[model samples]
Every structure is written in structure tokens, then in C-alpha cells.
Target: MRRKILLLDTGREWGGGTNSMLELLKRIDRQKFAVTCCFYNNYSRGNSETIESILNSIGIPVIFIPQRRQPMWAKLSKELLRTLFFFNRSLKKEMIARVDEIWRVLPNAKAISSIMRAGQYNALYMNNQPSTNVEGYCAVNNLDVALIQHCRIEPQLNAALVKRVNERVDAVIAVSHGVNQSLRQSGVDAQRCFTVSNAIDIHQTLPDRAEVRERLGYAPETFIFGSIGSLITRKANHHIFQALGQFKRAHPEAKWKMVVVGSGPEQEKLAQLAGTEMIESHIVFTGFQNNPLDYLAAFDVFILASRSEGLPRVVLEAMLVKTAVIGSNVVGTAELINHNETGLIFEYGDIDRLSGYLMTLWQDATLRQRLIEAAELRVREQYAIENYVSGVEMILEKCIERRTHV
Candidate 1:
């Protein structure tokens, strides 16, 4: 019989992790494993296709948890608590998080448990970090389903949460070795942790670079530097702005522009920083594009200045598209970009060094071409979608086998 697996995702917005998960689901071995996906939200953004619609198009079953509206009294109580603890920020934040856990997460856990039981799933596959999927771990506590967590980021877990994960989760899949090391530091058993680097479909077609650049109002000769991902503090896009500002001041004769693709809470702050840096006219913010690959292909260089990552899928996509990459020396990124070979790496928050590398790539076409060539070859040889799927399949089979023995 096919090993039945229920995949759960709790994100309200679609992200790189979700994109990677969709890729995996589309190509996973269907004859060996029957998979059902359950999402906490529809991930609706304006007129974009929802996650449910996308999955339905591919013949995969999707279940959405009914959105529960909090009562007015509950909202008022939370506000009152915030007002009462206004003086102590840490206490206030902790209190709010606890209240959210009680009012939101625990109820969701009950709902998740019901879905697991009704479906008679043999394994529960969580598509995010352990901290976010606390309910997934909780839902499988007393059930027979083997629990598996796909940690896509360096998790932020407190001692209590770490204990809960170690006690309940059957296995954990880290997207990179750095992430696997993080799991070990958080007290997750080494035997139960596996590192499966994220991958992409290398053969996917992309829009012509010239056409994409024209549509975005960029001239063919424009030296475009691009970054794609949520505009969050963790992504550290402001650092990119700082680096660009410094680079521009040093090389006033160079004609260049920075294109930031994707939207998040930090958009306003980033815009203000751009204006302050006097590069506002040289920067373009394409809020959120459904087909970022076109933009990726159009870029002369791709930059990722994230504080952390779970093997950034964007870097892999950038490499696959033959775009030269400059990324922060974080776990997942370091594995992909060898200092001067596949791509350049900068220490996180080092604006001066980042500016120098950006200048180097912009000035030296030969060096940029060499990096992209090596990056593309590396991605094609090692990070294919087939290899990623097989690795996860092997892990799933082992989880099921262990469950049977237990």
C-alpha cells in the first residue's frame, strides 16, 4: 500500500519555502506515497491564484482549515493586557505570544488532529520550522502518525518548545547542513535529523531577458542589480540599499539601478532608506511578481543579504538562470557560493565589503560570467529536482519503516 502522508503548512502568505514545497509535491513519487495537503490559510493576495487553486490544477487534494474569527471580548481582553503591560516590552511581547497560543494555536491543534484522524494518515509532514508548526507537533502527540518536520530556516525555539519537539517529532528534515547543525544545538537527536538541500527545475522556460527588461522599463545597457524575497528585516534589504549608496558614491560615473522584487512589512522603511541614501531614483520596487523568474533572468547580478536562510531557493533559481549571485555568508548560501568561484560572499552587515563586491561584479564582465558559468554548472549537476525528491522519499520511507517496527 502507498504510505499515506498529510502535509501541513501554516503560513498566511506564500514564500520561497512554499514555492519549494510545491515543487516537491508536484514531483514526489506518487505511486509510492499518497499525499494530502492541509493549509491554515488560502494565501490570498489580491487577484493571485490561491494555494488551493494551484494544487487543484495539478490533481492534488487540498484542505483548508476553516478561518475562525475571534470574539470581540477576546480582542478587547488582548488590548487591555497590552495596555496593562505597556511599560515592559519583553513581558508584553511574551504575554501576547502566550495569549495567541491559547486563543489561536491550541484550537488549531485540535482541528489538525481531527483532520489527521479522519484521513487515517500514516505520517504527518510539516512544511516549515518546528516553532511555527507547534500545532502540528501537538496534533500528533497521542496519534499513531509518524511526525516529520521540514525545517526551512534556523528555528527560533525556546527550551520548552525544543523539549516538546524532541519528545513528539519522529524525524526532522533540515534544508541545509547549517540548519541540521542548528537542530542538533536545539537538542534534536542527530539520528532523527536529515539535511536535504532545496532544488529547482533547471529546464523550466523563462521569458526572454530583453523583453522582460523592456517591459520593466529598463534599457538593454542598464546595469541592473536585483534582489528577490520578502522585504523583511531578516532579509536585510536595507543593507543592500546601504551598499548600493556607498558603491554609487565611490563610482559616480557608473550607470546602475537596483531592482527589489517582493513585498513585506519593511517596504516603507526600505523606501525611506533609499531616499535618504539618494538612490531613490536608481531603485525600483516591483511589489510582488507571480513570475519572479522573468525578473531573475533580466538581472545582471542577483543579491541576497539575508541574516539567515534554510538553503535559499532563490539563490538556486538565480544560479540556474545564469545570474551571477552575491549573498550573505549565512548557512544555506555559503554551501552554494564558494567565495570567488561559484559566486561572491559577504559577511552579514558588512556594507563596505558588500559594496566592493557589487562594484567588482559590475565592473568586471569576465568575472561575472565566470561566476555564473560555475554557478549554473554546479546547480545543474547537484541541485536537480529529481535528486531532491529522491532524498525526501528515502527519508519518508525510513520514517514509515520505523513506525511499523515501533
Candidate 2:
């Protein structure tokens, strides 16, 4: 019998993790493992097709657990508890835990447990970090089903949360070694952690670079620096603008443009920063493209200034499209880039160093070609979609086998 696995994601937005999940779901062996997706939200945004629709298109069943508002009594009680516990730290902690359990965790766990029981799912697979999937772990407690967390980012966990994970989660499939290390540091058992780097399809077709540039109103000769991902604080997109502004001021004769793809809460603030830097005219905020690969292909260079990552799929996509990449020296980005080799790297917040790397790539066509070639070959060889899916399949199978034996 095929192992019935329920993939649970609590995210309300579309991101690299969602894309990676889609890739895995599309290629997973249906005969060996039957999978159903359960999300907390539909991930709907202005006229964009919901994640439900996308999953249905690929023949995957989707279930949404709509978020319910807290009752007025619960809210008032929480406030009262807070006020009463103001002078006692331990009492405040207990009060908060009680409120959280009554208002959030218990209800969510009950709902998820019902779904698991109704579907007869053999395993619970969380598509995010432990901190975000507390309800998933809770749902599997004292149950026969195995629990696996596909930890896609470096996790931040408190003592209570760490204890909960160590006791409940059977396995954690980290997207990068950095993430695995983070889990270990956060008190997740070392034996339960596994690193399976993110991967992509090497054979996917991309739009013509020249055509894409033309469509986006850029001259063939004009140098373009591109950054793609959510316009959020963690992504540090404003740093890209800062570096660009610094570069432009030093070399006023340089002809370049910045293309930021994807939208988030930080859009207006980033735009304002660009204007303040006096490079507003040189920037294009192409908010949320469904196929950012086309833009990736058209770019002369791809840059990421994220403060942290699980494993950035965009960096891999940029590499696949032959765009020379420059990224901050963080976990996933550092793993993918080798300074002066595959691509360039800079200190996370060093605007001057970022600007210098940009100038180096800008002036040297040979270095750009070399880095692009190396990165593409590396991704194609080591990060194939087939290897990625097979690795995950093996882990899921193992989790099931262990649970059955126990």
C-alpha cells in the first residue's frame, strides 16, 4: 500500500519554499507515496491564482484550514491575565502559555488531528521550520503517524519549542547544511537532522534574454543588476539599492539599471530609499512575476542581499540562466557562492564591499563569463531535481518504516 502523507504548510504567501514544495510534489512517485497538501490559508493575492488552484491543476488534493478569529471572552481574559501577571515573570509566562494553548495551539492541533484521522494519513510532513509548524507536531503527539519536518530555513526556537521538537518530531530534512547546523544549535537532536540541499530542473526552458530585455524596455547594451524575492526586511533589498547608489555616485558615467522582482510589505519603503539615493529613475520594481526566470535570463548580473536563508532557489535559478551572481555572506548564499570562483560574496551589511564587487563584475566580461559557466555546471551536476526528490522519498520511507517497527 502506498504511504499516505499529508504535507502541511502554514504559510500565507508564495515564496521559494512554496515553489520548492511544488517541484517536489510534481515529481514525487505517486505509486509509492500518496500525498495530500493541507495549508492554513489559500495563499490568495489580488487576482492571482490561489495555491489550491495550482495544486489542483497538478492533481494534488488540497485542504485549507481557515483561520478563525479569537472570541471576545478569550481576548479579554488574555488582557486580564497579562495585567494580573505584570509583576511576576513566571506567572506571566504561565499565563501566556495558557492563553496560547486555549486560543491557538489546541484548536489548530485538534483540527489537524481530525484531518489526519479522516484521511488515514501514515505520516505528517511539515513543509516549514519547527517553530512555524508547532500545530503539526502537536497533532502527531501519541499518534501512530510519523512526523517529518522539511526545515527550509534556519530556525529560531525558544527552550519550550526546542523541547517540543526534540520530543515529537521524528525527522528533519534541512534544505542546507547551514539549516541543519542551526537546528542542532537550537537543541534539535543531531541524530534527527539531515541535510538535503535544494535542487532545480536543469532542462527547463527559459525565455530569450534579448526578447525579455526588449519587452522590459531595456537596451541590449545596457547593464542590468537584478534582485528577485519578497520585498521584505529580511531580504535586505534596500542594501541592493544602497550599493547601486554608491556605485553610481563614484562612477557617474556607468550606465546601469536595477530590476527588483517580487512584491512585499517593504515595496514602498524600498522605493522611497531609491528616491532618496537619487537613483529612482534607474530602478524598476517589477512586482511579483509568475515566471521570474525570464527576468533572470535578461539580467547581466543577479544579486541577493538577504540576511539569512534556508537555500535560496532564486540564486540557483540565476545560475542556471547564466547570470553572474553576487550575494551576502550568509548560510545558504555562502554555500552556493565561492568568492572569486563560482560567484562573488560580500559581508552581509557592507555596502562598500558590495559596491566594489559590483564594479569588479561590471568591468570584467571574462570574469563574468567564467563565474557564470562554473555556477551553471555546478548546479546542473550537484543540484538536479531528480536527486532532490529521490533523497526526500528515501527519508519519508525511512520515517514510515521506523514508525511501523516501533
Q: State the C-alpha lDDT per candidate.
A: 0.89, 0.90
Candidate 1 lDDT score at position 244? 95
Q: Give the TM-score of candidate 2.
A: 0.94
- Alpha-carbon TM-score of each model against the true structure: 0.93, 0.94
Top-lDDT structure, candidate number: 2
Q: In model 2, where do residues sit more than 4 Å from their true spots?
A: 45-47, 70-98
Best-fitting candidate, scored by TM-score: 2
| Superposition-based RMSD of candidate 1 using all C-alpha atoms, in angstroms | 2.3
Name the lDDT value of residue 172 in candidate 2.
Answer: 95
Candidate 2 per-residue lDDT, tens place, 33-91, comes to 99999998888644588899989999999998888888787788878888988998777
* Candidate 1 minimal-lDDT segment of 10 residues: 40-49
lDDT comparing candidate 1 with the true structure: 0.89
Off by over 4 Å in 1: 45-47, 69-97
